[model samples]
Target: MSEPQTEQGKSAMSEIQIPEMTGKVLACVDDSVYAEAVCDYAAWTAGRMNTQLSLLHVLDKNEGTTAQNLSGSLGLGAQENLMQELAELDQQRSKLEMEKGKLMLQAAMLRVEEKGIVNAESRQRHGELVDTLIELEPETRILVVGKRGADTESAHGHIGSHLESIIRALHKPILIAQQSFAPPKQIMIAYDGSATMRKGIHIAAASPFGRGIPHHVVMVGADTDVARAQLQEATDVMTKAGFEVTGAIIPGDADIALAEYQERENIDLMVMGAYGHSRIRQLILGSTTTAMIKRTKISLLVLR
Candidate 1:
C-alpha cells in the first residue's frame, strides 16, 4: 500500500524525543568493515532518539598479536631476571592493547560526528566483550553491532560468534548493522501477529525511534481475510501513533517474500520479533533471520 519514504518523513522525525524507558544508543566498534556502518547507523539512531551515543571497544584476553619466549640457555639467576622482564613485558603489552582500543574508539567517535551526533563518548574495557556488554546492558537503550567483521585487529569476527549470544542474553534491542549506512527512511516490520512481533509494533509505535518513517507490516502466506485483519489491526496501532502505516500480505515463503519486497521497495531497515515462532517456524524462521542478519542488504532492528 505505502511506498518508500518521501520528503514528508524528513519533516516529522525531527520532532522525535526519547522517552524514559530507553537510554543512550551503544555501538560496538573495532577495526572491521562493519565498524563504519555501525557508527553511522548508531549516529542516525542517536539523532532520532534524542539520546547520547556511546562507542565501546573491549580488549579481549587473547587479543594480542606478538608472542614472547624465555631464553632456555640462561643460568638460574639469569632465568629469574628474564622471568621478571617477561612479566613486565606482558604488562606493557596489556597497556599497549588498552591504548589501541582507545584509539579505535576515538576513530569511531570521529566518524559518527560526521553523521551529526554531537553527544558521543567512547569507552575501553578489558576482558571479554560479552561480559562487558552484559554489565553495560542495563544502561543501553539499543545495541548496534556489525553482522560480520574482518576485525583481524581485534577478537571479533561476527563479533567472535558472540552476536547470537548477545541477542540471547540481553533484553534490550540490537541493531545488526549491515555494510551500508543510509539513514533509514522507510521501515518494514516483518510481522506474523505474534506476541514479539506485536511487541515490536508497540515499541516502534510508542517510541520516537521510527516515527515519521513509513512502516510496511508485511506477512507471508495466502492473503486471507485473517491475514488482512491482522495486518489492519497492526496498521491501526501504528497509524494512531503518528506513523505512516501500510499493510502487505504477500504469498510465498516468509524469507523469500520479505527479501523480494525489500529489494523492490528499497527498504532501509526491517524490524521484527526476536526469538518468536513455533518449533517448525523457528526452524524455518531462524535460518531466515540468520540470513537476514548475515547476508541481507538492509539493516535489522531486532526487538526482544
Candidate 2:
C-alpha cells in the first residue's frame, strides 16, 4: 500500500515538474524590440524550468569613449586650437552613453518580471558582450539572446559576430528567441546519432530542461540502415533516461527539415549540436550551422 502511494506521488510530481530548469538563466538585452521579446522568451523558459533570469546589458566601452580618444589621437581630431572644446564634447557623449545604458537595462528587468517569474533581476555590464557572458558560463545553465540584433544594419545577415562568439566560446546551451514564444508545446531534438547529438539527447532527456515536455527525435537524410540504427539507439538512450519519445526519419536537407517541421508541428525548441563531426570537421562545415541559425523561427538549444 505504501509502495503504491509512493509511486503515485512520484508520477504526480513528474506531471507538474515544469522544465526542471534550476539555476539562473542569463539574457542579453540591447536597444532592439527583439531584446524585450528575448526577455519574454527567457522568462517563459525560466518559468517552465522554475529558474531565475538575469538580464545583462554590456556598455561596450570600445564602441564609446575609448574609441573616440583613440580616433582623436589618430588625426581625426580638429586641427583648430579648440582642444578643450573637443574634450568637453567627449565628456558629454560619455555621460549620455552611460545614461542610455542604464535606461535599457532597467527596461529589460521590468519586462522579465512583468511575466511574474519572481526571480528575474538585471545587471549592467561594460566591455565586450560575448566575453561577459562567457565569464559567467559556470553559473549560467542557459544563455538567451535575440535571434537578430536591434540594429537594422546588423540584423540582416547572420546573427552578429557577438552571438557567434558566445555560442562558440561557452559550452552552456543557448536559446535564440525568434518573433516570440510562450511555453513550448512539443519540442524537437536534432538527433544525428553523432556523439555530440547523443550528449544533447541525454541532456534533454535527463536534465531538468526537458521536464514534462514531449519530444520528437528527427533523424534527417536517406541512410535507411544507419537511420534505423541511430533511431533505435536514441530510443534506448531516452528510455533509459525516462522519457516518452516519438521519432521519425526525415528526408532531404537537415536545415530545410528543421524549419518546415517547426512550422508544421509547432516545435517550440530545436536542440542540436553547435558543431559536429569533430572540431576539424566543424570548422569545415560551419556555414551549415550559420544557415540553420538564420532560417529557424522557433527557439534553438545549441549544445557544444
Q: Top lDDT: which candidate number?
A: 1
Q: Which window of ten consecutive residues has the lowest lDDT sum in model 2?
A: 1-10
| Total backbone collisions for each predicted model | 1, 1
- Model 1, range 185-258, lDDT digits (tens) per residue? 78999987665665566678888788778888888777766667667767877888888887898977666778
lDDT of 2 by residue, 196-301 (tens): 6665666676776777778888877775665666676677667677777788877777788877877888788888777554457667755456677888877788
Q: Write out the backbone clash pairs for model 1.
A: 157-160
Candidate 1 deviant stretches above 4 angstroms? 1-20, 65-89, 151-160, 277-286
Model 2 alpha-carbon drift over 4 Å, by segment: 1-22, 65-83, 152-154, 239-242, 277-284
lDDT of each: 0.76, 0.72
Error of 2 at 277 (Å): 4.4
Q: Would you give me the overall lDDT of model 2?
A: 0.72
